[model samples]
Structure formats: C-alpha cells, structure tokens
Target: MTEEDSLRETRMPSLRIMAKNTRDVMKEPILQSILEKSILTKTQLETLLIDLVIEDEFENHISYKEKASLRSKAASRSRGVSRGAFNRTLNQARKNITRCFYTMLLLAYLGLFEFTFFSPFEELATRIEGYRRIRDTLAGKTDLSSEEIESYQSAERTILSALDSLSTSLSLKSRLSRRKTGSEIESER
Candidate 1:
C-alpha cells in the first residue's frame, strides 16, 4: 500500500472517534437546554451537525489529496468528484455550519446572561446588540474594540470550559455504567 493510503487508514479511526464524541456532545442535556432557548429547533441543529460532518470529511479528503503524490492523484481523479465542485460544496457547508454554530453560541450565551439581570427588555436589547456585533464581526463589516473582543472571548472560553467538564463527567458515567452491565452479564453467564 502507498504511504498516503496507510496514513488515511490510520486517520479514519480517529475521525470516527471524533464524530462519535461530537454526537455524544450534541445529545447532552446542557446542549439540549441551550438549543431549547435558542432560535434553532432540534431539527435545525441536526442539519447543522450533518453539514459540519460532511464539511469535515471533505476537508480531510482534500488534505489527503494535497499530501498524495502526482501518480496517486492521477489515479484517484478517475474515481473522484471534480475538485472544483467539491470545494464549492465544502465552502458552502462550512459557511452554513459556522453561521449556525455561532448563532447557537450567541443565543446560549445571551440566555445564560439574561438570568443575571432583572429587566427583560434590557436583556433582550443586550441580546440583540450582542448578536449584531457577532454578525458584523463575522461579516467583516465592523471592527470590535479591545474590551468588546475580550468580553466576547471570555464568554466563549467560559462556555467551552463548562462543556468540557460536563463532557468528561458524562463520559465517566457512561464508562462506569457499561462496566456495571458487563459485570452483571458475566455473573449471569
């Protein structure tokens, strides 16, 4: 087998594991709660996830192609889709997934932040402004001040840290539950 083929074989399992972890993370209650409070429905979230996964696969495939020798590339071209078409699809998918994820994160952050304030209108306005800033920043239409950027980055970091801790706990619980079930089955056998 070619070195590129061997590398791709080794990479597949890691990609599978990452996909599984992403699936597990999406099923998490915290994520569900956030989604409930967001503009996106469960179906929309699933669609975004699907797009993200497909984009990731396409990017990985492109990377593999970039690393392969000219002969291998020529051989693969006969079996592969047009690179230009693939790239356009990948870019579209990436944009969709990114927009959805950013919106979800902003909504979740606003939801969490709203609870600390007493006035509903004030919180609503805050959310609207935050979303505007996010949209503008993402579109490259406006530059964020240092303070604004720092606050946004801090919120993102805090949310990610919380999710990481929750994921770790959930993983441990799943592993322990599986072990318990295995032991019970062994005892019965």
Candidate 2:
C-alpha cells in the first residue's frame, strides 16, 4: 500500500474510537441528568468536550483549523463545520463555564457555603469523581468477572441515588414563588 493509504487506514480506527467514546459519554445517565440541569446547552457541551479532547490527545499544538476539523470528526458530524462556527460554540461554552465559577464565588462570599444546603454539592462532586474512577477501571478490562460487574452496577446505583437526592433538595417549592416587598424585608429584619 502507498504511504498515504497506510496512514488513512491507521487514522480511521482512532477516529472511530473517538466518535464512539463521545457518543457513549453523552449517553451516560449521570451526564444526561447533569446536562439537563446545566447552564451550557447540549451543543455547547459537545463542543467543549471536543475541544478538551483535542488538547489532551495531541502532544503538540495544532492550528485552529485542524482543531475544528478534528472536533467535527470526533462529534461524528456528517459534514464538518467552518472554523468560525466551531470557535463561536467553544467561546460560548467558555463564557458559561466562567459565569458558573463567578456565581460560585458570589455564593461563597455571601457565606452560603457555610450552610448545610451547599454540603450536598460537595458530596456530589466527590461521588462523581469516584464513579468516573470505577468506570475507567472497568472500561480498561477486556473481560470482567461477575463480581466486578456487580460492583460496578452497585456503584452506578449509589451515584444515581445521590444525584436524585440532590435534585430533590434543590427543587423549588410553590410557596417560594411569593414576592416580598422591601417593607416586608425590613419588617423581617
């Protein structure tokens, strides 16, 4: 085979693997629930993940054009988008991420983090990391014993339960919709 043909053959499998992994991650239950509640839109999340994958998978820096092309390919886009479109989405994703951090900072400054209400968020973060570790360990193995499969399933259920609990805690009540006038606030003080 010609050098060009050989290169194409090797590149195809890695590209396919990247596409498959992207799809699988999007389908994950925890991620699906989080995305539904997240500030970033689904398209923005996909764009952000693709950008991160490009940074992590490439040892050397690549041009924006190349990054955009790879991002499209990894996302399994039928036709690659122009670099401008991809860059726009990436920028939106970054803005949402920055805003989220700023909001967190505001909450901390208000001393809200000291309350028990925010403790679940910290727990959820730790649980999510543990879930990822369990998933990665299982994903690396070609074959798994029944015990390993059961252990992974248990971990999945535990994380899902924790997520559900957190969701319930954050849900707004009907009474919370009532508007209080400035006089009412002063009266409470």
Tell me the lDDT of model 2 at 86. 84
Instruction: Give all candidates' CA lDDT scores.
Output: 0.51, 0.72
Q: What is residue 158's positional error in candidate 1, in angstroms?
A: 17
Total clashes in model 2, counting residue pairs 3 or more apart in sequence or in different chains: 0
Compose the digit string of candidate 1's lDDT tens values, residues 51-111: 4563475465525232211111123333233445334444565666689788758867777
TM-score of 1: 0.29
* Model 2 worst lDDT run, 10 consecutive residues: 169-178
**Cα-based lDDT at residue 135, candidate 1:** 42
Q: lDDT score of model 1?
A: 0.51
TM-scores, in order shown?
0.29, 0.74
Give stretches of model 2 more than 4 Å off. Answer: 1-16, 72-79, 169-189
Error of 1 at 19 (Å): 0.9
For model 2, residues 128-156, the per-residue Cα lDDT tens digits are 88888988998999999999889888877
Model 1 weakest 10-residue run by lDDT: 64-73
